[model samples]
Target: MEVIAIQKSAFDGMKNELKELLEMTEKVTRKYTPIFKAEKWLDNQEVCLMMNITKRTLQTYKDKGLLPYSKLNRKNYYKLTDVQALLEAGQPYNTDGNGFTDQ
Candidate 1:
């Protein structure tokens, strides 16, 4: 193999550029990445308990678009705000004569 040498000044400049690139990347990530309140994010069990509904009913809510959820790692998560909104709406959970709630 042939030995090649790079100028120390050139190497230092390249290193500085790389550092700047890393800092810029971090700034962009912070700017663009979605910020979620950890407490606002509720897992399935927490939502079920809070809503006083079973898991099956929760699935039904999802199927009918009554509740919005995000699935991660094969587990479902819901926003507390959305759940509270549903409770306040007082329409989605009430079933009609057809046994399905009106959307």
Candidate 2:
């Protein structure tokens, strides 16, 4: 009877430890899941989609200084903020500082 009690106690302790491990894993996953607000920047594919351009077109824009981008480990990245600024500046509806219009 004592041996059975010892075995049951060990199994209970193991089960409790496994449950704690699973709870910890759940917490870690929730902490690291991606949040949409944290990812406003555009990668190459995102920029292509935004501008309706091909990868080659994006390269040309980068080469011509017409697009804003950054290099991370030799890979290019763009920001939505820069795209918005470019669109605003190029729009015909935009006015100069002196209130003069392009039209």
Candidate 3:
């Protein structure tokens, strides 16, 4: 019947539209997704962004032992909690070894 044929055509069109929509969504998600390195450690660039500090400043903290970090094959990683503590502290530039100042 013509009605049956029309229904089948509509169903096929809807199926194709759904497939296209899914593909589009996949592309969009891929575009927005962050690509992470395999090191499983945050690099200096990421640390600077998180702590709102210059890379040299982060290096200074690292050198002074004020910021605790882990080393993975020459790469450094600061814990999220450490970064949060640093933000909450609002201390001066010098590392007194006290770790985090009261804001």
Among all candidates shown, the one with the greatest TM-score: 1
Number of clashing pairs per prediction, in order: 0, 0, 0
Local accuracy by lDDT, each model: 0.79, 0.70, 0.70
RMSD after Cα superposition, model 3:
12.3
The alpha-carbon lDDT assigned to residue 52 of candidate 2 equals 57
For model 3, the stretches where C-alpha displacement exceeds 4 angstroms are: 1-41, 94-103
Per-residue lDDT tens digits of candidate 1, residues 1-103? 9988999999999999999999999997786455454447789899878877667677889998989998867988888889999878853564455455444
CA deviation > 4 Å runs, candidate 1: 1-34, 94-103
Residue-level lDDT of model 3, residues 42-85, one tens digit each, is: 67788888776676678778887778887766888776667777
Q: Higher TM-score: candidate 1 or 2?
A: 1
lDDT of 3: 0.70
The weakest ten consecutive residues by lDDT in model 1 span 94-103
What is the TM-score of candidate 2?
A: 0.46
Ranked by lDDT, the better of candidates 2 and 3 is 3
